[model samples]
Target: MADYSEASPPPKNRQIVLLLSFFVGLTIALFLSVDLMVGVLIGWIPPGVERQLGALIVPAFEQQAAPSSAQDTLNQLLDRLKPHLSAEQQQRDYKVLYVPDETVNALAIPGDRIILYRGLIEQAESENELMMVLGHELGHFAHRDHLRQLGRGLLMQITISSLFGDISGIQSIALSAAQTIGNSRFSQNQEYKADEMGVTLLQKIYGQVAGATDFFARLSEKKDLPIDFLTTHPNPGKRVQRLEKLIQQNGWTVGDRSPVAESLKMP
Candidate 1:
């Protein structure tokens, strides 16, 4: 038969190659599906719905939060910063509120709200430091991070409900996951962008970069810094170093500047 058996292909080897290729293609498709799901979770919500969601959530938050007693002084700082922002930034009515917490924290809520905690204000060594904190919150708003975060929380709730099918068993787990999502860290890129915006705000307000790194320098000394680094923010040491580099690059002086408004008291 002219060696017909030798002419046949290696069927076992061909099957193995086909099996490997199938798995590779399946892996790629799975990754693409995950990427699409993440996009929908974070950015797919409509602006109107996002605003309505914010409006609804604000009331619940207000019930739990104590208003700032230093509103008048904080308002003065807002006025000064307002006149310097671009018209686009001015278009949105940004409002600031003070929360009565002792933790050094601040939050940028949806619907043009910035929650400034008293502890953060007390931690400020200068008005510039406080201004930088305000600027960072504004940066979060300008980038729509607040809305994105809210959307993610909502999506998580939907996903958990859909996956579990039974409400009673999974309700607690779903709630816990949603809370974690709400408090989760923004990507490193977002943090750096906020830092850049804060620096730009300082330059616009004061003709230099003074006090840009002051608060971060102090923050770096805390024992909880390592824990904080793994969570929401970059390490304070890295932030200070980056700010210092920015100052040197712009040839800005790190000199003493104007203090907080007289009406405001530190601590």
Candidate 2:
């Protein structure tokens, strides 16, 4: 038998080539996936603003006068919702803030702060609809999305820090290349978790849940609402599908249909 124990190792050149190819392929695939998903999430965004995340936070979407009456309605909804929602479950420490913009959007910040845009408030067809939508935002927060964003360090720094020190420009170039894929690199399991939790929140307040479903149905029918690759909410049609299914399966009755929880609205 051959003296296998004494056999020499693979040649250095071959090892180097193998290693280089493996790393190169891995890096390409990893970043490609990341860029793709972020791109899709922000798809409805303007092309220029969509390109760089830093650009999206800017001078401000037009500021508006939030009517006192609307604020009262919102408060009524949150009061009921607070007991039902898991404050600690979503890794969020949330306090609601009103945004000045008219476009229906809500965002959760790192410190448990959620900004409810005026646009989102006014557009909601009913109090239930707004609660359902708010539930999703809360789901994102409890899931610790803010923490994950921080973990990414700098979307710009990943290249320079991961590669050679001189590779600063490579960050932008790399991000641009990755944007084409538009597939969120995070495991699909997370999305499922959000969906399930959101449903639970909706179940507790199905009237609000029904409102959310109705709102999505309305949004799906609209020609003007920007449905883009980068937006995270998915399509209103898909949302309606999921929301309706939840209702049908549980035969859940509507909860307080009065309006946005009174305690949640700003004074």
Candidate 3:
């Protein structure tokens, strides 16, 4: 009989074959896992998972967004608005965040996160205008605007990852999509809803029914970037037009009185 050891394949060749098998297995596993996660999460169109993810990332760093001084101001405003907002709406998937950057923008993330750039505070005409803006952002949360953005992003990530099958490429795609969707403009329709709701909230809280258009008007007419990547607010003119219509149609004339905030005079 031939010696069994002599008949066996060379150790070097066996090692190489084993290495190939391991890599192939690992690749398959990773592909399957990523694909499966994307499919499962997005497949049935489950409600609020989008909100959950947004919430997770938005308020992650406790002390990240604003400095202590600015935060103190925001907290005071929030305290004033607290009692009037429905408890459910009050604890929206959003938190007031302050970013020290000079960009004049405030926006909502997937969760209860609303970032107020220092530039935004500087741009405020009055405390009421600030409320109007915050109220508008809250309207987005209430209307599931951020959740819709999250859905599109989740779909985009899954698609890009599945097509590429390269982990690093998929990660990069996800990052880009995440950033884009977070900053993407709300359509005219969504903007209208926010304007209406924000106006309603403002009217209710302050009993002063001023058009929130002034905020957008300032940006729209600016020689510098009234709208740029970091400061892309919805078109002020369109938003103003819509809000004005709602006020007339809904008879949303002011007469509310809250005991909290320092009231702004309404037109």
TM, every model = 0.72, 0.54, 0.63
lDDT of 3 by residue, 152-266 (tens): 5566654454454545544444454456654677667777887777788787776667635667667567767545432355567666677777778877664433322222221
- CA lDDT, candidate 1, residue 178: 33
Comparing candidate 1 with candidate 3, which one achieves the higher TM-score? 1
Give the winner by TM-score.
1
- Relative to the unseen true structure, what is the Cα RMSD of model 1? 7.0
Q: CA lDDT of each candidate?
A: 0.67, 0.52, 0.63
Ranking according to TM-score, highest score first: 1, 3, 2
lDDT of 1 by residue, 119-179 (tens): 7777776788888887887788777666455444455654454454535433443344335
lDDT of 2 by residue, 82-142 (tens): 7776544423234555665555666554334455777676666556667665676577656
What clash pairs does model 3 have? 54-110, 54-111, 55-111, 65-98, 93-111, 93-112, 94-112, 94-113, 95-112, 95-113
RMSD of 3: 15.2
Model 2: lDDT equals 0.52
Clashes of each: 0, 28, 10
Superposition TM-score, candidate 3 onto the true structure: 0.63
Ordered from best to worst lDDT, the candidate numbers read: 1, 3, 2
